[model samples]
Each structure stands twice: as C-alpha cells, then as structure tokens.
Target: MVIRLAIVFVLTFVSCQEENDIAAKNILGIGRMQAVAVSGRLICNGRPATNVKLKLYENEILFDRLMEESRTDSNGQFRVSGSKREISRIDPKLNIYHKCNYNGLCYKKFTIKIPKDYINNGREADRTYDIGTLNLANQYPGQSTDCIN
Candidate 1:
C-alpha cells in the first residue's frame, strides 16, 4: 500500500511538472520578436542558378518555423529577412532547394546555420549575412533530397 501510494504521488508530481514546463514554453514562444536577414548567390556549373528556392527558418526542437522565403533572381541572387516572437534566443537557419546536377524528381536541399550575432532584438534586421556564391553542382555536407520545402 505504501509503494502504490508513493507511485501515485510521483506520477502526480511528474504530471504537474510537465504542465508547468509546457506553460513556460508557451509563454516563452509568445512574445519578444527577433529578426534576421540573409543574402547569397547560387551558381550552377559556372552559370547563374536562377529561380532556386531559399527559405529562412527559426530552428526549433519540435519543428522549425518558416520566417521568410524567396527565390534567386536572374543574377542568381536572393535576399530573405524574417522575424519571430519568442523570449528565448532564435536559432536562424537558411535552406536552399535546387536541382543543379541531380535529375531526381525532388530537389536537392542544403542548410546553412546563421550565427547568433546576426539576430536582432526587433522586427527589422539590423544586418544581413552574405553567404557568398555557392556552386550547386558541388556536393555539400548535409545535402539531401527534399520534395517539400
């Protein structure tokens, strides 16, 4: 009887702790907007990689939140800026989806982690990170096939 009672008490405490953790996370995710910006050029085999899709996301534990998206212009240049409201510091990352060498049905995807120093505390980004020119024909680390961006 004592063991059963202790188990019940432990479960109850654990449940309450879980609820409090969830509440804290919800509160932290609700406000305190932060912003970031990124720009880069994509090249494929010495040519401009136009119309390549680029997205900036706030990397999270459960799921990443999309902040902004854009496509490479005629000159293979893209600029994306976005903001998210969260009390905790934001983890900004950029995703590139393109088909340069692979002839598969889905596009090749790669990720670039933005440094924390570039994240601003307001809605507008103070500075933009230039990733420089990338040749999509070359294989990059963590590259994968992504049908959905």
Candidate 2:
C-alpha cells in the first residue's frame, strides 16, 4: 500500500510539473500573432507547371498548422501568406505538391523553409520570401510522396 501511494504521488507531481511548464511557456508569449508570406514559380522540364498545389504552414511540435493554400496560375506562379498565434517564433514552411516527373499515383512533395527573419510579429507579414524559380524535374534533397496535401 505504501509503495502504491508513493507511485501515485510521483505521477501527480510529474503531471503538475508539466502543467507548470506549459503555463510558463504561455506567459512567455506563446499566443502572440505572427505572420509570413512566400511567392515563387514552378517549372518542369523548362515549361511552366500550372495548377500545382501549394501550402504554407506553421510547423508545430505535434501537428503542423496550415496557414494558406493555393495553386499555381497558368504562368506557374504562386503566392501564399498566413498568420498564426504561437508560443515561440513561428516556423514557416512552404509545401509544394506536383507530378513533375513521377507517373505514380501519389504526387511529389517538397518543402522550403522560410527564414526566421521573415516571421513578423503582426497580423500580416511585412515582407515576402521570394523563392525564385524551382525546376521540379530536378529531384530535391528532402522530397517525398504524398497523396494528400
């Protein structure tokens, strides 16, 4: 009985400590609004890759939060902007979904990280990260396959 009581006490203490840590993070600006924006062009085999899906996201600890989503225009250009309230500096990234070279059922996925300097502390981003033209035919370093964006 005494050992069981000790175990219960230890578990309670650990849980309370975790809660305190969360509270401390909140107090340190966990929910302040931040924003970011990105724009770029997509090309495949020297031609415009039109109608390609793109998404902007705030990378979180457990799950990523989508900020904005759009598709490439007929000219293969796209722009995405998003804002979120976060505990720390928002980790912004752009996810591109396309079928550049693969004939598989799933689309090719690529991620481009926006530098921390571009993360603005406001409802709207002050500046946009220009990701110049990216040739999708050339395999990227950390590319993956995704059926869902």
Candidate 3:
C-alpha cells in the first residue's frame, strides 16, 4: 500500500509540472514569439521615402495608444513587432510622417489601418504577418485620408 501511494504522488507531481510548463510558455511567450510582425516599404511619389518615422498604435474607442516605433531604412523598408495580448484588444494602425505632396497638396502625416485578422493572437507559434508594401502619396481633391501627428 505504501508503494502504491508513493507512485500516485509522483504521478501527480509530474502532471502538475507539465501544466506549469505550458502555462509558463504561454505567459512568457517562449514558444509563441513574434506575435505580430509588420513589415513594408514606404514609398512617396516615385522614390523611396527613407528616414521617415513610423509608429504603431492600437486604435481604441477613447484614444489611440502608441506601442512601438521604427524608422525607415535607406530603402524605405521598416519592420516592427508587438505582443499578441496588446494587439488583440484593438485594431492596429501604422502612422507615417513624411513630406509628401501631390498637386500642390501636402501631408506631413498619414495613417494605415492594419487588418485585425493579420495578428496571430498567440494561437500560432512563430507567425509573421506581412502587410506588404505601403505606398504613401499626397491626397488629391476630395480624397479622404486619416492623418494623426
């Protein structure tokens, strides 16, 4: 009877350890790294808009909060990362600051809405969502745009 009791205790300990391991992975994002990867090229007119400031924001009802930021490289390419928990709550947006003009109209800042489904939400391990190329141009007459900055 003592031997059977010992075996049962060991099995319980092992089961708890397994559960703790999974919980740790989920909380620390060990196996779920790279929850959201936003990468794209910033183009203004016909040339690469290099050295532009890019900011990531979570669009909420009351206000939009900035999460991460990155600058465009020499080729106007940028990449930014965010956690699943922060991005899953609200819609993500990419804000760009540049001096782009079209037909005598210029915009110093612009925003791009990121699709909600693009975020992994920690369900998939090592997932990356490519937002593709972002072509930023000045607004024409009667053209609607979202600018914050």
Candidate 4:
C-alpha cells in the first residue's frame, strides 16, 4: 500500500508540473501580444515634411485592414505600432498623404513597402522596427510607381 501511494504521489507531482509549464507558456505568449512599434522619418523636397498623414495597412486579398495612423512631427518623424502577427504578414505597406511635388506637379499620395525583415517574427520579447528615411520627392527612381495616386 505504501508503494502504491508513493507511485500515485509521483504521478500527481509530474502532472502538476506539466500543467504549470503549459500555464507559464501561455502567460508568456500573452505578454508577447503587445504592439510592435514602427518608426521612420519623411523627407520631401530635401526638408522634413511636417504633419504628413501616415497609415499602416495589412495587405490582404479581399480587403486591407488599417492598423494604425500617425502624422509626422515638425521634424518629419513618425511612430506607429501594431500587433506583430498583423504587421508581419502579406507585405505590410505604408500610405503617405502629402503634397510632395515632382516635375512641377504635387504627388499627393504615395505608398511604400515595409520589408518583412523590419517586423519581428515573434522571436523577440520587445520588437521595434526603424524603416529609416523615406524621401517623398523621389520614389527611389525605378521602383514600383503604381503606388502613387
């Protein structure tokens, strides 16, 4: 009877440990669900484009979901955040509405690709991506211009 009790106790202890492990993992996952920050600067006509509207969209097949929106500061800096899962999928893009002129005409709208590498793949506890400088005056020369409207 003592041997049987010892065996049962061992099994109970092991089961409890497993349950605790799973619970800990779930807690960690919940903690990671916080927003991932994205930051960058916008330069137009060789100067900071202040108050430019910037929007984050999750590119989807049927419809695009707007995740966050921000306006450039006086220094042309902006910061936005979204869930890591949403921002890391299907090639996220940034839509900028500004009056950046090109060839005597103001290109009022533009889109820029946010590289997948800029998003954390759920491997880091804290994630923030800096997309560097985006120049509205020039759309990187021969890049896809269809995003301009």
Candidate 5:
C-alpha cells in the first residue's frame, strides 16, 4: 500500500494537465520542449523602423503554430523566442520575417543560421540561441527569400 501511494504521488507531480486546466496560465509544459526569447532590429528603408510588425517562421511555413512576433521599439531593436535549449539543444532554428510595400510592395522571409552549442549572453541560459540582426530592404518587393549572410 505504501509503494502504491508513492507511485501515484510521483505520477501526479510529473504529469502535464493541459486539457485539465494544467496550471492554466503556465507558459510551457513540463515535457521536452524548447523556450526562446528573440529581439533584433528590423531595418526599414535602411533605418530603424517604427511600429514594424515582425513574424517568425518554421518549416517554410509561417503562422500561429511556428511563429511569434513583436514590434521594434524606438531603438529599432526587438526580440522574440527563438528555440528551446534543454529539449533540442543541437537543432537551433530561427526564421525572421519582413514585409515592405514599395514598387508594388514586397514581403520576404529569411532564415538565420544558428548552430547548436551557441549560448545567448543576455539570457545566461545554456539552452538559448540568438538569431542576430534581421535587416529588410524594399529594393525587391514581395520576394519571400531566405536571407543569409
């Protein structure tokens, strides 16, 4: 009877009760998933943009599932969650999105290369990675190409 009670206690502690209102406001589950905080500059017209909407992408698709977005402050700097460190440390993935309207308007999405083992200095957490600066130009409108340098 003691052993049965102990096992039940352990199970209760480790389970994620999402459907059951599991810690309703809890940001992340106890399972193996990544956590990220992202910020950077979205250069509009070669300068820090104001109220520029940002988007994140994954698997060549962009939406609610694989993306998080934020606006750049007056400094033209912003951040977003990039990846999870503890669960998938080696596979760091970051895709920054931008949209500009000029000469018929153009929108583009670019991928930033981040290797595993890269640590974010700001977070001081080993599981986080940085996708540096993302600059967008309206030279070629609406060409959703993966920008890499």
Candidate 6:
C-alpha cells in the first residue's frame, strides 16, 4: 500500500511540473529577432552606378512583415529586425534588406531566418549558430554565396 501511494504521489508531482513548464513557455512564442541591411558597389559596369530605390523582401510575402526598417546609410547600408521570444519554435527574420544596390528601383527584399534550437538545447545549439552564418536565397547574391564575417 505504501509503495502504491508513493508512486501516485510521484506521478502527481511530475504531471504538475509539466503543466508549469507549458504555462511558462507559452507566453513567448514569437521569439526575439533583429537584422541589419547593407548595400555596396558590386562591380556594376566597371564603375559604381547609383542603384535606385530597391525594396528588400523577407519571408517572401511583401513589404509589411519587417519588424523594423532603415534607409541605407551614405554607403548604402540598412538593417531591420523583428523582435520575437526565443523558444522551441521558429524565430523571426534576423536581418532584412531593401534595394540591394539601390532603393525604390524595383526593390528586392531578402530575409534570414536561422535554426535556433539553442533556447531548448542550450550549448549544443551554439556550435551550429556560430559555426557559420545563416544564408537565405533572397539576399543580394542569393544562396550561391556565403559570408560569415
């Protein structure tokens, strides 16, 4: 009788713990996100030709999903971030670019979403997140190129 009672108590405690965990994690589903946009001369007709207004796209939807937007600096640089909670789910775009070479001239948008399981797995995920940079095709050079610097 004592053994059965103890088992029941243990099970009850575990179930309650699981319930608590679920409750705690539910509040942060979106995940925190941030991004930087940049534009530069890429051997355009030998000399740099000022690219016109180019709209950068992330997640391939439209010009609305971006959490933040910035005009390119004098050197053509921009960064956007969509803040969301960091949990077991997929996070928002880290960086967004509008007008790869120029702005408002048939703008092309790009989004970068990374596989962030670190919140749940911890250290193990760091290796992947650090080993390289996450590259999404929509960027200026597309997926064919990779940069982690």
Residues 1-149, candidate 3: write the lDDT tens digits. Answer: 99999999877655554347447667876654224557888788768878888788767555565667889998888887655343134477777777665343444666677765676545332444566666677453343433545
TM-score per candidate, chains pooled: 0.80, 0.79, 0.57, 0.57, 0.47, 0.30
CA lDDT of every candidate: 0.88, 0.87, 0.64, 0.65, 0.48, 0.35
Stretches of candidate 6 exceeding 4 Å from the true structure: 1-64, 85-88, 94-105, 115-149
lDDT of 4 by residue, 37-144 (tens): 568899987899899887877675555556678899999999876543332243567777776774434436666667665665453325557878888777553333
Identify the leading candidate in terms of lDDT.
Answer: 1
Q: Report the C-alpha lDDT of model 2 over 15-133, residue by residue, as the tens digit.
A: 55434644655688557878999998999999999999998998876567778999999989998999877667889999999999889999999899999999998889999999999
lDDT of 6 by residue, 110-146 (tens): 4344444422322122222321222222244342211
Clashing pairs in 3: none
lDDT, candidate 1, 11-70, per-residue tens: 775555434644665676665778999998999999999999998998977668788889
Higher lDDT: candidate 1 or 5?
1
- Name the lDDT of candidate 1: 0.88
List candidate 4 segments past 4 Å from native.
Answer: 1-35, 84-90, 102-107, 121-125, 140-149
Q: After superposition, how far is residue 99 of candidate 4 from its true place, in Å?
A: 0.5
- Stretches of candidate 2 off by over 4 Å are 1-30
Error of 2 at 110 (Å): 1.1
- Model 4 clash pairs are none
Per-candidate Cα RMSD to the true structure, in Å, reads 6.3, 6.0, 13.3, 14.1, 9.8, 13.7
Q: What is the lDDT of residue 140 in candidate 1?
A: 92
Give, for candidate 2, the lowest lDDT window spanning 10 residues.
13-22
